[model samples]
Target: MFVRTENFRTFTKLYPIITTITAIHLVLWLIVQFSENFLHLTVGYNLLVFQGEYWRLFTPIFLHESITHLLFNSLSLVLFGPGLERLLGKVKFISMYLLGGIAANVATLLLAPVYYSHLGASGAIFALFGIYFYMVFFRPDMLNTANSQIVLVILAISLVMTFFTGNVNIYAHLFGFLAGTIMAPIFLGKGTYTRSLSQIFPNMRRSPSTAGKGQSIFWIVLIVLVALGALSRFM
Candidate 1:
């Protein structure tokens, strides 16, 4: 719903870091579906990590155990990631995502059971959601009261799910949320103005002038090609 209404047109216009991240997740999901060894190699907090493989700390964020898990995370990311990326720009947005998710994984390694195998983008998605929650109050202009209430409702539901659901990892969610809260002030800066996707691509349309129209078309094709190229890796 968020993707259909708020981001449909804009997704084509702007550099969608959120969508890119989601695509990466989906692509990896596809790989995991096709390969048996993929999951064993990439999952976080695994026995391999304890044995000296360190990259598992970050690789787990790219994995999901089931379609339901990926679906919920993808939805949350589609809702929250674009907004934050639009507000913070690509660099800071990505930084927050990596740092927040990694923080969650690190915390999980310390707090969760050694035998527990954690995977999926729930922590990262929650990290973005936590930043969204923080922005609701501190950057009210960007996230209005109505949107704020929606975020709260989603978070409340997630918290309830964490407590009630057997497979949910609350520790990852908690630490990710904390990481987001801690990083928001640093990456979000003091700006309150939220830039629309259209604003980022004001000259997206074909113009009457031949050169201008050509340039616009070139840009559109370039963006589409890049997106397709990135997507082709998983297929």
Candidate 2:
């Protein structure tokens, strides 16, 4: 499958932004061999989701089971990521990718049966799908050049494929998609990226202005916790 550049020019214009992030993740993936090996699904695999090894939730998105898995996922980055990056800008776009990925993996560890180990960019990709759905459904006017038809079509197919695909952790994808959908109103709102939470909340009636601040804090704490936990796992 391919998303044409002409149809998604807004996404194309910011291709380099997401490419840089993908490159950084590629490098990070190489640094941790264990991260590469652990983020997989099998008949039986044990993880420290609650006990620790929290980074396992994130590391798998950085690795690929095979070249084909990497190819399709990177293609998705080329296809959809640019548009999202354009919408969310360099910062939040990256945050969505990383956070969505982490959330999916962590949820798998916390919720899914231990007999299965989950991995892939599917959760993050679904995050994009869910977020776009929110924009088209709730804040269509704010989107620069969004196509409602395209959004609906993409979501419909994604859901159908989710049910049919055997290797994928559909549960994780659903959780990430739900998370992204709920969070979109905050990111899509006025001054989401440029302004602080305090500033946005006062003007905002529906969402707390501190929404942005809360997201920032969440990212910071998540990063620190993952970092410290991963370091201990390595030690």
Error of 2 at 188 (Å): 1.2
Report, for every candidate in turn, its global Cα lDDT versus the true structure. 0.71, 0.59
User: What lDDT does candidate 2 reach at residue 37?
Assistant: 37
List ranges where model 2 is wrong by over 4 Å: 1-13, 24-46, 143-146, 190-235
Q: Return the TM-score for each candidate structure.
A: 0.75, 0.66
Q: How would you encode candidate 1's per-residue C-alpha lDDT over 1-235 as one tens digit per residue?
A: 1233345667745647777888888999899999979888888865667788789989988887666666657766765566677778899888888888888888888888788788878788778877876776666566654456556656776676667666767788988988997787677655555544343334546455644444454345434433432332343
Worst 10 residues of 2 by lDDT: 37-46
Per-model clash counts, in order, read: 0, 3
lDDT of 1: 0.71
Q: TM-score for model 2?
A: 0.66
Q: Write the per-residue lDDT of candidate 2 for residues 1-235, one digit (tens) a residue.
A: 1234344454445466766656745664454445633334211133555545565666666665544455555655655666687668888887887777777776777677765665557678778777876776566564422245445655666676567655667777897788778777777773333322243233335445534554445345434433432332233
